[model samples]
Target: MRYLLYALTLLLSSSLLFFVQPMVAKMVTPVLGGSPAVWNTCMVFFQALLLGGYVYAHASTRWLGTRRQSLVHLAVMIVGVLFLPIGFEPPTDATSLENPALWLLGALFLGVGWPFFVISTSAPLLQKWFSTTDHPDAADPYHLYAASNVGSFFGLVAYPFLIEPRIGVQAQTTLWMICYVVLIAAVAGCALALWRSAEPEAAASEASPPAAVLPLSWGRRGRWVLWAFIPSSMMLAVTSFVTTDIAPVPMLWIPPLAIYLLSFVLVFARVEWFRSLPVFTLFPLTLLGLGAMLFVQLGSPLEWVAGIHFLGLLIISLVFHGLMAADRPATRHLTEFFCWMSVGGALGGVFNALLAPLIFDRLLDYPALLVIAALAFPPALYSRRAVQITLLIGAALAGYLVGRDVMIYLGLERSRELATLAAVALSLGIPTVIAFTRARVLTPALLSVPLLISTFYLGQPEGNELHAERSFFAANQVVKTPDGGYHKLYNGTTLHGVQAQDDEFRLVPLSYYYLTGPLGQLFEVLSKRPERHPFAVVGLGTGAIAAYTHRGQEADFFEIDQAIARIARDPRYFTYLEDCPGECEVILGDGRLQLAQMPDERYELIVLDAYSSTAIPVHLLTLEAVEMYLKKLTPDGILAFHISNRHLDLQPPLTRIAGELGLVVRGRDHWVDANDPVYNLYVDGSDWVMMAKNEEAFGAIIDHPSWHEYKPEPRLRVWTDDYANIFDAYILDF
Candidate 1:
């Protein structure tokens, strides 16, 4: 009966802890914008929460009696019941996006705070209870932890592949609530067993062993932390690097996290047979070395390697971690070991996710973590002093040769000078070894190779011309597609804008919905406007806005990317710069930042069509963003937003912004037949949002040749960088 209760408790705790991650994380994307940053940040928060709960359980056993501990947990559980079925309060107004941290905090408080707190504390609390009740027969509580993480792994994978696909968010929430109730009942059963156990106090005291003791010092504890931290943090940094550089898809966060959890499972499993030895031995050597090697080739094929490489690092890191766990001290020291490990984790998150971006332009965290890992794990010592010196010297020479050759291949140093530097580097290793064996000379020398490599990579700034540039988080590249049309590529998302005209290859606007239906009507009205039309194009994609330029007409553009700006404004790439020459001025920076810089500026038409596919620039739709547009536009400026998407509904967010700004917004859903002459040369199927300051502008659009009636859904809240929610808007089927 006790065993059954333990099994039930394990089932309940595992389900609660593991499943909430993906479910709540997906729910928060729309609120925080669907950037990979959100998911990474959520991981940091969850790990911190788990750490806190573990500390709480430790405190519970030390200060409170078992009966009192159960009563206290029961009361907390009751309080947590108030957060049943996991849901957050809907934002009340458009400004909600302005403060996303606050928004995230609120959602966490209401939706899962108490419940997560309870579940997090359960594994440790229950383990302590078992040790006390069963005395000598009680197994190590630490082994159960292996089961706990296994549960977490299942929960993480199950959500995206199963629960989310099978049920909508509402139904998923209901199922979670049912699971929570069952867990509470199981906990009550455990408490009943504790009360009814007939073991005499004296026998229990005599039979139960004293709390497990640590055989290590503070310094050793610190080493354990370094092991745990370097890998976990490196995994996260690699996740950011891969997603930011290779693909910005929503699911990209999964593999890195899954591999991270699986590492824990392999290291902690009761039996060693399940862990693969080859992976433990060979994969680490290759990954640690190759990961650093690839750091030298950022824009080449190395840029395209996905989470699989990250998975390799994870498995290798776990092999070391498993080796460490096998040698872990007594259970009494587990909390101390973990506390320091938590410190390393928190530092890693802060360093990689928060500090790295602010300090450097491109991703530097991954390389830094690699060097740290190498230092943390020095090569095995040789049996004899002379032999040790020889082995060290040989390793040094090989590393130098490999490092220099790799650097030359990556275009860091001139090829002609490679042989000279190679000779110099190799020659120094022998003398360096003699100098190092006599003292600590090799410490700084060994560290310099990676440091120099890191410095070289970081120094090679990504170009911001039409072809190349790197932003705070995303890498931008330009290419001529097979159709002979230019495209702007940000990560994996393609932005199709202007196509070269068939005859002379003149620039033509091929923006998704520009040639048909309601969008055509707006174009006609804007074309016929008496005044010279001034326009603001928020997202500069392949300089497509230049297609609308007319002789003797004045125009200006607002592009957030310096790279995109160069593409649109450079006369050689797009004719708009040549034809309209001096008619427009390009601004650079975040769209909102530049928009605020030009409060007195106005435009007759505004196109907010700049999207890098998988990522939606959330700041562009905030209430503040809407007001900026309203203030910057001529009263008659027609705002056209390209809203084509496979995963999200942007209209509601736009409508909410429009309503807040007192502007009327309409949408044009357009489809084109290539067989039709005028439409054939344009967008095949497009969706565009058309907004006007008031009824007069709306009337003008309606009177245009292609005007069509547009009705927008009311009450949709405006999205801001701080508070956008895409869970409801996600188009899962597509």
Candidate 2:
């Protein structure tokens, strides 16, 4: 009964720790414009707090007697309880897009930092407390760590599937507070067990058996830090890359984190799972496979790409964490062991989440950690001769591939497809052969070269006159097509906007905003109004919408990323903003927040085009946002939303919310004509929703056959500041 109490205490506390991270982050997303950096910043703060908790546990256990230790921890728990019902208080001052990472960090610390810090200490502190108890299982409390991570795993999974879908943030906070109270009771029970045990000296002597092993030296401590650091850094890097490049869907954030926690559980619970032959052999092969995938631009079918990356991350984490678990010190030094591990975790978070974005122009941290992970593995599997031979073969193969790529670029007769296939096969095949041979020394050198070459050469955008820029938000690239006919802007793998370079069509609205598309039709109808009213655009992707502005009208662009705004206005990359006849202004902040600050309705038409990849900013699509947009619009103004997403069908929710607000909604699905001379030059298929205060407000475009009344789904849930379920909006078939 006592052991079960200890288990429950650790489990509940750890669950709360993980659950609060995502829940509170979701609450704060709107304030920061839903940038991926918001999550990364939260990760840094959580890691730092986790390190602080571990240090507290170490100090309390090392200095205090068992009874005193329990009392001290109990006191901290009481203080933590005071911070219950976790919530965020939005900063009174407007959050700047210039340094959103810092702003988000401040918000998280101020809101939930105290409670989170207390809960983070529970796993290590409680396990240390269990060690001093008279219970039968107290001799080996490492199992409790596994139980804690299991709770963390479920906590992450439940947030998206159970909590967010079923309840609002306020209710989730209430439930979390209830759970925290239960944890406090469990913790108090553990303290009583410690107090009821034998006297302090005798209990200490029994709990800590004499050293069967020597004290851990600095070298061994360094190894523990390295082992923990690789997996920690890799987890964040994988999450950032997938969310930014593929989709920024909040649910996508869960898988990488779940894999990370599950790795800890498996390795700590059963080391044999990672010691087997299949696990060892596949680790290097997966590394090579991920490197190959990174080299090529595998557009569309994101599932396949996401799957391979997830698998690679899981395998790598298991190997490194398994090694750390295998080398763990005796129970007497457990708290110190965990303290060093937490230090590594905090360092990894800083490097990947905070430092990488500031120093590197791209996400070099992901591939960089892959190289470090390869090096961290033990080299005992290889003889000296085998190591030399593998390095020789790997070097030659890398040279040949680099030469082949250079030749292809120089217009050699070699087929590009065949050369690429050959390179990928050689990269994967070499690592597979080395792993089967059990040549461990060759593993690091052989695997790293391919990853480096892939990241530096093959992974880069292929074109002449290419320019790349990185901000706290995302990495942006402007590239001219190979034929020199067009210039394109890319946010990771997703194309943001494009422009024809030819003089005849240079100023025309191209890509999704072409004159024949729904956006174009929206402006055409707006042009019919007698007054030249002010226009507002949420996202300034190459400023393509600026082309629709007439001579007398004024346009204001609300762009969250300053780098993207600069790219759109610069003539070298695009000329939409510069060429527009109307007066143009750029507001650098979250569109909804900026619009809310406006004193009155002034804009004739407001366009919501701010999406990161296919992931719609859930905050911007909520009912409250729609209300804010309406408030900033003229009486008959229309709200246009670019809802063309590859992964989600947002129309149902938009229609449902507008209907409940008593607004008129219309939609158009514009498809491109292949036979049209300007097919790729200007228009692409797009889906857009236009809503207004009344049906008569859409008079100019109402009679057009292209426009259709948007029907609301009676069963669909309306999204708002307090409640939203993106899973309901997800297109499963896609």
Candidate 3:
């Protein structure tokens, strides 16, 4: 019963820690763009807080003694109750908008900072407290660490699959507050148990454990930090690659985090056989396979790529965490071990989330860390000279193929891409096989391959790149089309919008925003209708939609990224905004926030083109958001959403929301052939959905061949700010 009290406290506290992350992110969705940076910033804040908690635990246990520390912790817990039911209030200043990550960090701190700090202290502090108790399992309190992660894993998995689909974000916060109060009582119970059950000998052994221990050195501490750092960085990197680069599956970040927590669960659970597993052998081989896939597209299904990378992350995390777990110090140093681990974890977040964007033009941190992690595999595998000779011969053959491709790079863009693929294949495949055969002999060679490859681009993306910049929001690029006939804007790999470079076609909308596209078709209908106030565009992508506005008319483009706004206004990259026949202004803020302030402007048309790089701005798609948009529109105004995506079927949930709002929705799955007689249109396929109060609101476009009444499947549910299921909307294109 006494041990159960300790476990229960760990469970509730860790659950609160993990649950509040997504709940706060959901609250954050409206205030920020759908940037991966937002998630990482939140992680950095939580990780920093965790380190602070560990510091408090280590200091208090040394100064106040175990029994007295518990009394002090109880006081801290009671004071934390003042910050309940976390809420967000976004900043309105123009300067704060430039670097949203800084603003987001401050806002999250104010909302959940105190309660989270209290929760963070529980894991290590309780484990330390448990180690001094008379309970039989108290000697190895690491098992409680597993229990804490179980709570973490459960909370993370539960938010999307169970809590989010069923309850709203607002209610989730209230429930979280209630659970937090219960946790305080559980923690109080543990304190009473510790004070009552601690023996005289246990008190004397406070400074040292029963077992003999070596002196803790700086080198030993550094190793612990490195071990913890790899997994922390790998988890975020894998998430970015899988969702943005490989494929954007909704709720995809869960598996990597789940695996991360599970690594702790396996190691700290003290599963004896796990220690003997051949993780070092599996780590390099998995890296080899994933590196091949990363450099060369095999035309494999999305599931295949996702599966291999996920497997690599699992093996790599186990190897890193396993090393630190094996060297865990005596029970007396329990809190100290965790404190160092938190420091490493916090550093990893800072590197990937904050520093990497400032330092690199591309997401190069992932591959660079992989090479660093490979160096940690203990060199237990070796082979004879004969095996080494044979592997070297195989590597020579692969090099020959890579050279042949490189020789053809002067031919065309396709040839250059093929050459790059060959080089990567040689780098990843040959070294991987050679290392696995004689790991120690080729380990240095293996490390050099990825470092060289990741540091320089071999022209893999296949375009005449004109401009590139990395921001906390995302990596933005402006590149000329292969034909050199058009300029394109890209956020990561996803093309945001495009414009023809020719002076004759400069004002004409191209790509998905072309005259024949769904957005243009909606505009065609709007052009004939009585005009309302200037239309509002949620996403400002090269200002392509500005072409639709007539002379003397006005249009407002709400752009969240200041960098993107700058690009659209710059004549060198794109001239859509400059060529606008109407009065145009780019408002620098999140679309919803900017629109909320414009209560008097009754826009006749509102276009939601905010989705970039498959990062769905789910806050904009919910029932509450739709209601807000409707309120901002004229009596018969139209709400248009650019639903064009390669990985997600976004229309289903919107159809469900239409039913909930009792609004009429029409859609068009429009595609323009590149080889059309009017090829200069430079258009591509697009999907758009527009909703109105009734049939009369749409005018003549409703009866057009491209427009249809789109409906949702029976299982699809209306998305509100409180509840959304990306899984239901995820397209099984793989």
**After best superposition, candidate 3 residue 276: deviation in angstroms?**
3.3
Stretches of candidate 3 off by over 4 Å are 200-212, 297-300, 378-445, 458-461, 530-533, 673-681, 711-716, 728-730
lDDT of 1 by residue, 1-734 (tens): 67557645865687668788777876765444455556666666666676777677777766885667887887787777787878766564435534444456567766778788788777667766665565344444455556666777788788777776556667778888888887888888887787676543543443322223435777776776677777778778777766555554466577777777777767666666534454444433443344444544443343235534665567556755764565555544445445566566666666665566556555667666666764565334112343334334444644666667767756533532344354356446544564556443343344335334544454343332245444433445554444554443333334445555353445545646354445555666677767755677766656556656666655556554455566555655555555542365565544555655664546777778754454666556667677777777887777788777644567766777676666776676666666777653535467777778776776565555454445545644445533444443444233
Supply the global lDDT for candidate 1.
0.60
Cα miss at 572, model 2 (Å)? 2.6
Q: CA shift at 520, candidate 2, in angstroms?
A: 1.0
User: 96, model 2: CA deviation in Å?
Assistant: 3.6
In candidate 3 the C-alpha lDDT for residue 482 amounts to 75
lDDT (Cα, tens digit) per residue for candidate 2, span 255-280:
88889999888877744667444566
TM-score winner between 1 and 3, please give it: 3
After TM-score superposition, what is the CA distance of residue 734 in candidate 2 from its true location, in Å? Answer: 5.0
TM-score of each: 0.64, 0.91, 0.91
Please, what is the whole-model Cα lDDT of each candidate in the order they appear? 0.60, 0.78, 0.78
lDDT of 1 at 694: 75
Prediction RMSDs, each to the true structure:
9.9, 3.8, 3.5
TM-score of 2: 0.91
Question: Where in model 1 is the C-alpha error above 4 Å?
Answer: 1-4, 89-111, 135-137, 197-216, 273-280, 296-304, 334-338, 378-455, 464-734
